[model samples]
Target: MHLESVVCFFAILSLGSIATADPNPNQTGSGKQLYRNRHVARQQLLSTTTRSVPPTQPHVTPAPTFTPTTTGSSTPLAPAAYTLSNGEAAIAIIGATYAAGIGGAVLMIGGTAHPLAAGMIARITGGGPNGDTPEVEIEDSNPVTTTSSSASSSSSAEPTPIPSPYIILFSPNATAQEIQSVNSTLVNHAAPNSLSEVVSHGTGLVVFFKAGINPNQADAIRQAPGVGGVFLDETLGVDQLPSSEQAPLSFASRRSIDTDTPGSPKASVRNPADIKLQSDAVNSLKVISQPAGAKLTELPGYGYAEEAGKGVTIYVIDTGVNAINPEWSSMPGHKDILYAPGAAKTKKDFLNHGSCVASKAGGPVYGTAKNADMVVVKVPRHLHTSAVFTAILEVSNDIFKKKLKGKAVINMSLGHLIPDELHSAYEQLLDSLTAMDVVIVTASGNDAEKGVNDVTHYPALLGPTTDIIVVGAVDNAGYRAPFSQGSGIQLNVSAPGYVDCANGKAHPDTQGRWGTSFAAPAVAGVIAVWLSQDEYKAKLQVEGQVAARVKKMVQDLAYSRVEGQPPVIWNGIDPRGLSCASDHPTGFIKVFEKDGVASGYYDVSSNSTTGGVTENIEQWCLAKCTGPCVSVFLYRIRQSASDGYYICNQYNQPWTNNLVQTGVAAADSGVVFTKSLNRRYCNSPGKTVSRAS
Candidate 1:
């Protein structure tokens, strides 16, 4: 069927079913109007069929300066993804009521106002609800109308408009040496169809480098100095059109972020050689004993936990997995969920990476929840902007359609270190999930050293609409892994995942599996455990409580205070050991759960220090430097009424990581801190926070 025809069919169907719905002042005319932008983009693509896939190598060109396209439909000019995916509001203005040649359909912009979007627009353009909005009685439940112009196209044959290229940042800690090194490498290796540009933000610098030449050349650029890392730097056979590009998503671990897969792993234990592992919760367990503990059969005193992963379902939006292992031999259902034109993955999927992740969350091997159901997607480990963005949307569509979609938690172990087109799509997807109260978890990328502490993996950088759960790694001694991304202001909390993926003293698994990639699921598992609790039955409640408590617990309980370290603001470097802002800066947090928390941690890099990655951001922000921690994820903290802990409120602190900051009407007063900062004393109601000098 033609794209227009399909849309018309859906529109008519919708209108017929809603004949009795209330008339909306927010929506003019019938709600069945077709979208003009979708039609325009599709027409553009169809007319310029050659433009569907972008060139392998692309040169950065100035944005085309052209007259705005004439509007064809008076209907909404807004796109569906933003309105449809986000559930906060269902009303919006698609196109201006008075614009010339506007399309006829009236599209409800479809969702609640985006806080960051609102702030950014206000900061940049100065357009927003002003003095006229406050005194007016506004109902929070009423839908809102928004108006925007549609992208231009040459003709009506093409149906979809292209997206403009953009970049988002997590945090950047590149020193002069590192930044210089990265810059030199890219400039020197500049080749065909390649483009590089750096845009610094409050968090870090976004060095956007496009693909050129071949895979080998791309690999070389990926290794450029100052350059932290690169993925598909060029178009994946797709165009650089505006509509085609989207930013990668961010996810937080604070929302009762569960790493929990189906259920804790289980075994029969009929023989005398099995490893004695016990289940603590679904898709979660601990290795109680390992002797001449043959992993294949049962030990004399060991018993197996026969189980199912209960009602929870967890998703892994990475590669596919081996679903037929003995561990999953009895699983009721396991399916592959990836599709491309003439390409679809089947039950016999490929998931070498997925297997490792599953071992920690869902299991055919060992996991937090043995019975937790799983949804596996076979996205490429590395992909071009178009492919990655498309993959993100496709996965979200699947999530919307699945029976287990609402309650399941999703863990994304794969990511790009830099923000790209996929970011926006991922953000919308997470917002969709958040509104439904689905748990989302992601690993902060593995690039922590070489002063790359600030940049994070995809989905890990998304905003609060996700109610996401973000995680970093911790060492066996209960301190943050030097390489583990910190929650300073952009993330949530930590978990005991190490380079080797070990569980306890004397026994380890997956040796050398270091990276935040290996650490995230531990937090996921913890979220799963929390979800099983009575108070956290609702996914939204689980995320909020767990995220809040996580920050509190970690700040108060984790790690021992190291003495005599250089203070963040030592009045003078050696202003000869002059008084400093902090006599002892509490730089680390520890994790503690009820007994039998089904915990696992590895012992490597014992000499590693916590907070290097995040502390860098705190320092940058404190300096009132351009870069500030955009959001804070309070992963864990000590329970209220616990001893010796002073109440800390969330306020905008400036550089030097000191509580004393300037410019805010009241940086020290009450305000909801940005979700990215993960502040325990956030803009949320809490006492002001300060560190001892």
Candidate 2:
């Protein structure tokens, strides 16, 4: 291998060139000082080069050495000239030598040196006593400083001299309409020449300009229509930019990392044969396969050992869990946090929406990951502007203020971008949970036509400390779900969630299952399982631990970035790269790199609840708050075991006290005992009793 340059600049002076002349004081002082300073520069440059690379490499390569020739100098450089160290100049010369490959280094040209370049040299080796050597030395020695402008002009003549674009952040609250306004405003303000590209983050948007766009511009937009707030893009900086890969901690700041590595108690990735649907509507539902812990002999768990989401309390801090399943009631520690009273205090499905979610989420013994416990908290929603964010913050308050033991994993299947007092509260709660080390998972959203602009949803935008796992919807072919909200900007990872929103003449899968909203719970369940496993424990944090695990598992299972793409690690996206002007920012999730050469999927959606409300009511009567009639559940059924609502079925299925039916009882209503709990259409529980009607 070739040896690296010994000194950035080696003066090969010929000894024979020296001229014998009488002593000139002015010449002696300047010439003598310059010679000594040059010598010091020589030594330091030699040292830096030698230590830079490995010593094992051969150094047989020929190197030009420095030599000084005697000359009668005009003005002598003062003693201060010796202050500049060789290290300062060497870096400059190297920079000038290789401008294309590396950046950030300043090139100080001589015979033609740029002032800024000179300034950089001076800064590198400065005035302080502690400083290795003063920049005064190099400053005094360079005679051609005046011509620096010309040299820089010459060097810059070549293409690609401009610095890379700065990273800019966008607002999530920005809607398509707002984005246009902001883009126009930015164009009008300074660079009226060109338009700024808007990066859409679905519910939220991020915009980055070729030129710098300060926080003020962001603030200005905040006051504009549909704008939320603006903040600096803090995703990149010098430390995070990459200095020394192995350097001992770059900054003193403390950040959290997911402690749940593979060896830990956490688990990842689980599949099931089928989720047991409700008894009444058997027409459309079918158990293609049983979920984990359902038929253990058939489905089985993913880990080396069986792991269930036992201790981890999963709180769905959005529309509360409608929870009608005998399986939904089976979970222990399941509770509701409806702070808004009659509204958020709902146990009944609001429009039957909550039930559809709980069905797939906390569900029939088969749906709940063998490892997780579920909690459904209803957060009020303003359809035009999703206001459920406060529900999450309220849940966080319970975790932080109450110091709620066994913090729950929050699953928010709903999202909206409206800023108000709710946001302030939301931030407070997320900050606390992130600090407490709780994980929050949210859907990437399901609002894209032909899938182009995918903006990020929040609480998904929580701090780095909080492991806010943003999931996107993916189809069985590993392609991004058309309805699934996407964009590389905010999604952490994707999951299989493509059924179909509503049957459309265009898309037959409509109403079938195709949205990231559904995909989020699966991830929530998997996270719960990982948390329950003895191996994960308190190891993984939401950020470093859980996010990392998900990334690894996705890649390990051969998950590519996109359908026809390569696998990308859990690397954060360049928020600046997003184009708000385009659609489906998160839609780029094709399958970067797959488990096999190609493959895999995710699901989440927004609909007016799927399983139908009436049936859910009957299921509730027979399972959760149902009285003595609870004895006939397919999974497990029994009356309250403790002071709370709970039941145990013949199959040993465990259920909790949830969603008590308003009216109707077994003995009074005559809900026959032939099959345990049965429903009737009469006025009171005592009026009509029908096992088979």
Candidate 3:
């Protein structure tokens, strides 16, 4: 530590070769008085270093210390000044001369000082208070002032500098009185009226500070009793410039290619023997088979009539749904399709976008969740960032007013710039929607030719929030659609956008409907299927829990065209893991581990509508453990008591790497199931289980 110096000048009297002097009254009011003031100031500054300022009454206390020395009559004798290299050197120099009453007299220059310097003085002694010393302000060769007790006082060590116009997140438990105290503190120290836009959501409040306050104010705010955390209100915008690009496919009837074709590069129809039919209206249209003879169909749910979506509400936030159309009005739940007042109350599809999207969501014949109802939210033709934000807020509030809190899914096919400037606000809104049990689904965009990244869109690239799911379009041939935009980490899954529909026909069709716009609704419709089930409906009761589970179930069960590519969602709503028989028990679970080795995975099975998981699976690994295992997965699964097979599984596998090295159990645990809900079964649920050597 460098020495902090406090000095004074005195007049010298020469009676011989040697010189002696008395304190000059002009320089300081009586040397003894200056000494006492300096002593108090030094004590106060050091004592207050670890103390906090009172929020209600913010004030600075003064401490000062003074000293005097003998000098020649015409000239004052300068005190000995030594510049040490660092604080430690200054301490050593002062410690060596402690007997001379010059303890702590080494002037620390923040940096190191050299004794070999020409103008440096080595040692000198004078009378003064000896405890923690005051920081003496030296200006124009005279000692100006010597006391400092405020929190804003500058020192050799840097403090947490307060950034102006920053946001403070108050603790969840902060009271109104504590909030008032914080306001008083800011007013007294930073500025008279430094705060703006104080908004509260749930238990948290977001407030802004004025610009150009003392940079050290952040430290004070952090130390304040009521504040939880503080962050700078940064402005971030989309890196890619916004463009008026068109979607990959325009509105038209579905592609009507005959099952038999010759010399057509894209045509690859299934054989007659493999084609499965449910009714005349719903037929299993297989386009591609991966392992050569393996059959895949568009309408995969053939006989599962009980899985029709029931009591699920799909919000189509798109270019207005036209209710007057015969295709829409004739649907079972058509009366339930409500519209936002600003989006116009009439049933009019101005762009033919919302109609196609709504059909894909729940249009009875063409929809994924056959029985789910629809709520149309129309966005403006030419979108603005502010308007879209306002639309989200307005729609959220509308949902709240409508009392559609849980089991409500939002399907947005519109695309907008995710400017870097609005990342915080956008994130805050999405998080709020999630906490309220509302799930938002948005398209990954259709700008693959333009080389646009998936996250370039606002809601789609809103990062990894459990409540938002981003979808990309895939063609009938089980390949990623050439025009579908691919994302970095946020894209959840892909779905069929190329549905076969007849032109000028009464039936709803997805044939000509392409782009991520149509793809998003397909996934939304699939989520509606999950919501319809009593098992998933119970899970949806907990806000922000089901979206992650849905994504996981799809990831575990869905087939992909190529490895590492996003897997496409199941062709039909009733997949083996999403539906169940009466005897197939389902439950929720929380897994735990021992030193990254396997421990216990507890399963809480729900017996009634109240909801719970009652069983657990305990796994024990034989040594080879080295790291820690995180508590991942919140699941709802269907297991057959006799066969020990996981029939319908819905769980969240956190997208993080937990395994440190290779082992038999180190593979994706998501695909694994157990016998008797314990380690002995060694079975895989979604995929085939194999033994390790």
Candidate 4:
């Protein structure tokens, strides 16, 4: 039989016997209209099917009284009336009878049936012969909408978009309840678990929201009671340069050593084995000592106090240190490697940058401050600016809580460009930390290629404010490295940018690391050494004095081969005293002779002695003729006929020969003067003045 003929035959038979029932009193006008529409549609389907073939003789039969059946309960289940359209009713009937002919009645519907349609099929094809019920399979399709509720449900099935992360810093005075209330409001406005506390220091409570806040939402947050500022949390990376260009080790191929293995080498300056490992790599350490002069080929040994950085704690905020590395291990009194919360269980030095940094800062074998305690703060390898802020805040909070103000040093070998509005927030953070007497050392950044000044580099740019020490990079020769950012006043001091340090590998390569990342830690290590000293410890006891004192001491004791350049950092070990020639007074030179006439030289100031005086006037010149003192005059005043005392006079202007003097009378009256000379006197003539009589 043709498919249409079979379909028409089944359609007519099923429709001819559909029992009519009383109209549903609960149905509304729309429902009644829908029922009528379905009935009309069935009639059209029957007419179309019949025209395709000779119509079967109409067999008129009385509609059978519907009898309901119950499986377990005595109450019979009423048969439901279906409101399917004509096409749908025909498909159901064709499916049922076709399956019945195949010995097992199996009806397959194109889409899920409306509940009423399912009942209608069950009633039409009662249980098959021998009571074996036919199988019904529903192939999923676009939902059939026969009611308003079905349409409403289909519209609600779309996926929700995810929110982005943001950070909000609350005012310092915001109470816990107020903070909680604000958090509650934000949570209700965004997805669940949207607000989390990033840091809660004395300055403010920093909270992070994963709500992907819109401008209006951000404005709402800004206007909230007690809220200080709202910032979009942005991603950042380690300050270390990309390995392919400048870094020695490829980050992708970097390996981590198993520190748990037996016989691992531990770093200890006193240990013979540890010292041997460091003997070959002391160029960076050797260069930091004494004044910058001839290049050093061999290690003169790092001159430092035995205390090294004993009680000081260096918090390295970077990729995280390899705590298992022997460099951090085996220290007797100060071997504990502290970690911030959420950083303990992770692979500590995944990128190798952090380990190298920490090693240079305080590693026993390779660090400048070999005995310092270390706190490793592990941020993401692909660091975020918010994470950096949180780390800094956490360290500050930790130091404050532990009363480690002067003893704590934070080394940030990382930086990124942030929005202008955030600059104040950063300054406030550093200012707050410095106020607590903590020392902060940061890299000037390796952004020379960007052709921008360090003013664009943060934290480092904040160096001018005296709250932080910004360190740039220098080569082994003590000249500023080509890649080091900032010069002159932009940098506090420079350090060896390239160095051999632990890289967390089993067999670390000899290719030394390079970048301001390494330079920063070297200065930090020296700061640790300073903090470890008894004098600095006492001086730093005064709150807010650490940064200023450290800056002055580092600069005063720095090694500068060139006169105008910012000096490279020195560890204050065997400091070379200031040289008058090296002082390089712009237009002044050494006085070749001291004539017994004081008229030409301006007697700016004088230093005299009552006791025995050795008239080495050059030493006096070096002492008194510092800044702005252009000339010095040695004077001998007769206290008695035979005894005389010497006086040293300093002048602001160079002495001139035109001023007349009364020869021996001025000389007898003890008026003798020396004129300021140029570089020619020191370089060519090499003349010397006789001691005053």
Best by lDDT: 4
Q: Compare the candidates by TM-score and give the number of the best one.
A: 4
Global Cα lDDT for candidate 2 = 0.33
- Per-model TM-score versus the true fold: 0.37, 0.37, 0.43, 0.53
Q: Where does candidate 4 clash, by residue pair? A: 164-212, 589-677
RMSD of 2: 26.7
lDDT agreement with native, every candidate: 0.32, 0.33, 0.41, 0.49
C-alpha lDDT (0 to 100) for residue 423 of candidate 2 = 37
lDDT of 2 at 325: 37
Q: What is candidate 3's lDDT per residue for 1-693, written digit by digit as tens?
A: 000011000000111211111222112212222122111000000000111223345323211122221111222224322222212234322222210111112343223331211111223222124333322222111112222211211232222223245455455456666666555545443432444333333223322222223333444466666665555432212112112222235221233322221221112321221111122132212221121223334322232223445566788766566565433554555345443323445566545566767776766445655556677766544333333444555555555655666667888776543333344545555565666666678777666656544444455655344446878776654457656675545577777655532111233423344567667776777677666666555545555466566656555445554444456665332221221111221111233212212212222211211311122221111000101211222222223333221112211222232422224242223322221122111211111111111
- Per-residue lDDT for 274-295 in model 1, tens only? 1112211111122112111122
**Alpha-carbon runs more than 4 Å astray in model 4:** 1-162, 199-214, 237-242, 245-281, 291-299, 331-344, 449-455, 509-511, 562-565, 575-693
lDDT of 4 by residue, 86-116 (tens): 2232233312321010011222233323232
Model 3 worst lDDT run, 10 consecutive residues: 1-10
Cα displacement (angstroms), candidate 4, residue 53, comes to 73
lDDT of 2 at 33: 24
Residue 675 alpha-carbon offset, candidate 2, angstroms: 25
lDDT by residue (521-556, candidate 2, tens digit) is 656665665565655444453443454454344334
Residue 245 displacement (Å), model 3 = 12
Between candidates 1 and 3, the one scoring higher on TM-score is: 3
